[model samples]
Target chain A: MSVKIEASEGGRPHNEILGFGLIGSLVCIYLTYLNVLTGTEIFSFFGGLGAVIALAWGSDTIKHLCSYGLGTGVPSAGMIAFGSGVIAMLFATKFGIAAPVAALVIAALLGAVIGYVSDKVVSMNIPVMVISLIELAIVGALTMMGLAAMAGGSFMFADLVAGSTTVFGIEIASYGSSVIGGSVLAVIFILGSIAVQHPFNACLGPGEQQDRTLMLAAECGFLSMIGVAVISFAFIGFGSAVVALLVSIIGWAYTYMEYIKLSRRDAYDWLDAKPIHEPKGGA
Target chain B: MENLVLGIGITALAGALATVAGAAEDTESDIGSQGDPNSQVQLAPQMGYIHRIYNKAVSGEPPAYGLWCALGAGIAWALMSIQINAVLAIVLGSAIAVFVQGVYATTAYLGRTASLAKFEQPVYIDIIKSVTTVTMAHAFVAIFTTVAMCQLMIVALGHPFPLPLLALVWGIALGAAGSATGNPFYGKERQYQEQKFGAGVPISASGNIVRYAEAGQRSSLDNGWFASKLGGPASGICFGLIVFLELWRTVLFEQIGAGWGAIIAGVVLILVFMVIDRYIETWARKTYGPYVAETEEAAS
Candidate 1:
């Protein structure tokens, strides 16, 4: 039997990373609104970057929560975060320009309540459960909003739910269905869930390190950005979508290489495997 | 003023349905032996204690229910768009989702059991043929009730979210409630019955579950019957309260002070629960005390 030993006073505190992540991502995502308010899509990619930053923080929160021996709760926690985030986001976006701050506050309250229930009613008995869940809920909401902003060029409810499209040379009012009515929100939900959950699930073990896991988290975020960028063709112009796609690819490549380097540094040894041997005759 | 009364009515009806859905969801999972306890069940045969427990953990509770509820609600939404009767649409959609869940249950059980062939654990066709129907029945109740609740939110309460999205959100919440609140009762009290009550699972006893029944070998069917009594109800209350309180706060306080009232109510509710939780933890600790080593107890 192997015993899991957690450090009590080592590495960066989750709160510190959370502060940087929260402030940095909020600034980036809110700045992207300049494009929407100006009726331009130039700064849409900043929303994608904001999503990556928030997801990095979300990955750390997942790691901290699962470290408490949640058993099968790893996936549940991820789903719960997104589930609550979506509702809070839907509500917050109705406030027009205040969507970002509104989503942050709404998700925190929702997360706090859920965390309290998990600990008190369900008796999870973890000390940091409430705070960790609050961070996750907030991150989940922001990541979704960022991705939505990336895809639709705005986070406002009116823009997402009723934005028109230009077909051929004519501008089609409502375009039969808007970005959200066309089921882009569903796609965002699944993509955000996978991006937030896959990092720690892939890297967790006795040998797991925070930096490598966080790098992988960034890589996953960029990968999700690529998907969101591809889907943006349904909403934004081709030139803007292509720009987001290019930025996502560059970010993904950089982080992926950094993650690999960290993995090799922390690994005991690396071996290159040879091709499979053939048995002289083909089957 | 009329809207407030109508909202309260909708909230009450939705809360009741949520309770039923939550209970059925937990019971279905327990019957199938899904989630974390499933790891222990899988390890049983490898540890030289072969038994006939149904093992069908294809995924965790949240994602599974999310998929099921989303499909159900999506199909129903499509049918409703075509001017179909809402009740009939929900029933037909729920039926289709149950069929999908049945397929998953069968395949997961067969694949998991087949992999344990090296351990000499025989595949129980009888279980596959019988338990599949049982789980599907429970899943239908859960799916139908959840879909109905989403409909109520949309038609009665004027929730802005579309039907399928609402279903997805509540479905995930329901699965979380079941996984967190009800799973422990089935996993600890039923599977590891040999361990003393109120004492947590010891490290050494991992994967070593009680393999025998009172008269014959234990099976997941029996486990389900046991869990339905206590675990199912506990999960119901958990999810019910979550839905009730959330909707209740929004209905009463959302119009007050630019929605800060609802937010404040939520935070206040959380603080209250935190205090209650602190008391529960202390009481449980005082009652159970620390775990004593088995060897030391025997020696004494």
Candidate 2:
């Protein structure tokens, strides 16, 4: 099963797809925020979609940059993305409706600065390191905000730090836990990182195909959505949480199936396992 | 004025501590044969040269250190909240994190060596029994120093981020510093010394590394001995400069014009580094003169 591979084996150029994911996910996430202003949590799934799209793009960026022989840097890139992204995100939430846009800007600037440090002072010498890192940072910020929105129904500073204390017109003391204060933000950080980094790490080889890898990213993203949806129960309305959970589960199933199909298509042949024969005489 | 002075002092202390953390981190990673170079160590078995190196790359240096520092800071923060002495809390927290790091190293080494059994790669019990503790000791130092630095920034300099988050951020910076500045020394120089100096690693020599030491077969410890001198110190200085400059600007200019002064200083610093980096690149290209086949033929 020796198959020759060329550099053009992947589905699309990395940049074009990445640009689409970037702009599209940003728009969808902003739309989710706008929906929040309508006082309805029904459109919160758009936030999850935003996260998935950003992760898909981020995964592509990771694949592109880590190919420069980063060796173990695949995961490090993801961690740095979130590390900077979390700081930028927390800073951005201080703005009211402009939080998402603010987060994108801050995350971009932070990533660029870190990338500069990595290249100039540390002397990584990779040509695309700065741009890739910038993209990863934006992806980290958007994914974080999206998941936070999906979970808590709002990406506002007050809602994320100390959510409302009253429920059903009754004051519930000690129930003021928000996404950040309750440590849910930590889960989102790690979940987004793993989802963005894992697909490429697992699919990296001569036989790796972009379609399969992106599908796996989508699968991982949806799985992360399921996780955040469960956490949403702690903050959002029950109906919205259920809706998110259902949507996530459905999306995960579809993407997982597509990933499997792509894998099979790429494979030369399939072999079924059989039980091993015991030695002539039993041990 | 007093606040500025205190901030400067804290920044200086943090920068010094971060340097130690960076040095110790690179040394630990080299001893374990972690990061990009670890790929060669892994490939040694398949390439028909069984090695004694401890391959314990559970993850990249940045994320791994981030997890350790964050975990340590989290524990320390919790203990301090419960009225424990700060030093004791930090010690205990770092100790627990080191234990976790040791466990990860052990499992990683064991699992990796086990996978290479078919290639006659032996799992050196001595390496595991001894090297795991060595790496853990270094990790303990790195974690403790980083946590302490985070504490200094919070309590002394009035940094806004919480202890764990701040530790995570600095840990990432430390890891990136080590990976970028230090790893090349180990991966390019020490691990593949047989290659002509200044000639980059060729694609043909991907998995082939220098397998023999001066006396006998080399272990990761041998690499560590060489790396401790150049790689570790280089990484230390890189990280130290980053922390020192980053904090120096803020302390000096943060009070001016709604903190725009600090931002301007940061931009200026970046521009200076860009010029320096450009000069360094030119110098290297001139000195080395591209060690490719075409250049070699022309010279001949």
Candidate 3:
């Protein structure tokens, strides 16, 4: 089996693909928001799960960076990504509610600052750490917003505050930014983290292949979608949950089949070979 | 037929759970939003929260001791609330502790690792790659298990355990479990490190620290890499208890009680952790025959 994953083994540049996924998710988020605005909620279902495809882009970045043989190993990169992602996501949701565009800007800025510290102050020597983290934070924020949108039907500030405010004896501030935040969002955040981090982690080796890892990322993304659906179910967002569930199930089946096929193609001759033909009777 | 029945049953159950969650949301949705201009006060702070926190973190040229005191005080304040908000403690409070403690613990891990001890001038990538990654792994386990246990508490009992107590009890116990099991991942990470860096870590199948003598290269025998197999989890449990208990006691304890709690909890955690730690140590020694940690070359 191929253990080492070369930087060149990837089919496309990590940044280029990350850009595509980012733009794609933004477009999906915008369209979904528009749909939510006009009262045709039909399009909203695709927003959350589709946006996380950007995470596949993030996974690609992980494969590229970690392949250089990060001395600590790969999972740290994943943790850092998720760590930065979570903080960026929280900040995004806080502001994204008022002016949705603000969330993206805030996330990018937060990521840039963090990247700056990681590079200049920390002196990691890996110049790309900052930019990578910046992108990770931005994409992470977007994914979280996408999830909030799916859970609450709109990431509009008012909706979330309304949803999360726990009224105890008519006290005004039971919790701030409690809206768009729930056990459901908690589940999505954790699961989304796994999706963004797991594929590259599982596939890493000297023989690691880009395509296989990407497929693994796709499989993980689908599983995360399923997790989102279950959380949506918990909150009784039946329509959204069902839509997400159905899409994830179909997508998972397809990706899993492709993954299995890739495994077969990439396997040792013995494992890949058809069963040995046996003589039925004494010839 | 049996598979079909099981599938149908699970689907129904899932649907039922979704409906239940939806009902909960519906109840909340019933409340009217207070989105008037007065709510603007509430909204303004949310926007500037990041900026304010940022300024506090970086802008001050304060006394070093003062900052350290503030840090401890701040953590103590957060831990006090663990009783009322377990979820928040584990999520937000534990997060801060894990990041800081993860850094410290991982640094200690690197320092204690016989192979890595000689290396000078640690950089961000090296620190990030191993320390943060290892810390994240253990913390991830702690967090995931804490969440799972919380879920179980909810399902088995009608109400969830108080957040502070839960954080303390599970923070240490699950931290121990994590220390015992999945936490030694970094010890095995040398193969990758050797592959990438190629300084001095050569595999000597006979389990000796392979030395690198070539100019412009550093190498160490691979034999001692396994020294931290038990150390990984030991440190994990040790730090987990120390940090979690510090938070728990600070917020919950009386003046005299704090001392007793510290001594008692510290002792108990050590004793319990050591038993488990020794088991894993024995397990490793038995599995991989006793190996030497010394290198042929002088320590860097």
Give the winner by lDDT. Answer: 1
Candidate 2 local lDDT, B1-300, one digit each (tens): 787778888889999998999999999888888777878877766666555677875577777777678767765764564346999989987887686567557545644554444455555666767688888988898899999988988888888776767887888788889888899889888877988776677777766677678886676778778878999999999998998899999999998899999999999999999999999999999987765675767998
Candidate achieving higher TM-score, 1 or 2: 2
Clashes of each: 0, 0, 26
- Tens digits of per-residue lDDT for model 1 on A43-98? 88888999999999998898888877764566667778898888888899998888
What is the overall TM-score of model 3 with all chains considered together?
Answer: 0.53
Measured over all alpha carbons after superposition, the RMSD of each candidate to the real structure, in angstroms, is 12.5, 11.4, 19.5
**Candidate 1's residue-wise lDDT over B184-272, tens digit each?**
98888788899877567777677778777887677677877887899999999899899989999999999999999999999999999
Rank the models by lDDT, top first: 1, 2, 3
Candidate 3 docking classification:
incorrect
Give candidate 2 regions above 4 Å deviation.
A1-179, A182-283, B292-299
| Candidate 2, residue B181: lDDT | 88
Residue A191's C-alpha lDDT in candidate 1?
Answer: 60
Best by DockQ: 2
Superposed on the true chain A, the predicted chain A of model 3 yields a TM-score of 0.80
Off by over 4 Å in 3: A1-5, A8-10, A40-42, A94-100, A164-183, A270-283, B1-176, B179-202, B206-300
Q: How far is candidate 3 from the true structure (C-alpha RMSD, Å)?
A: 19.5
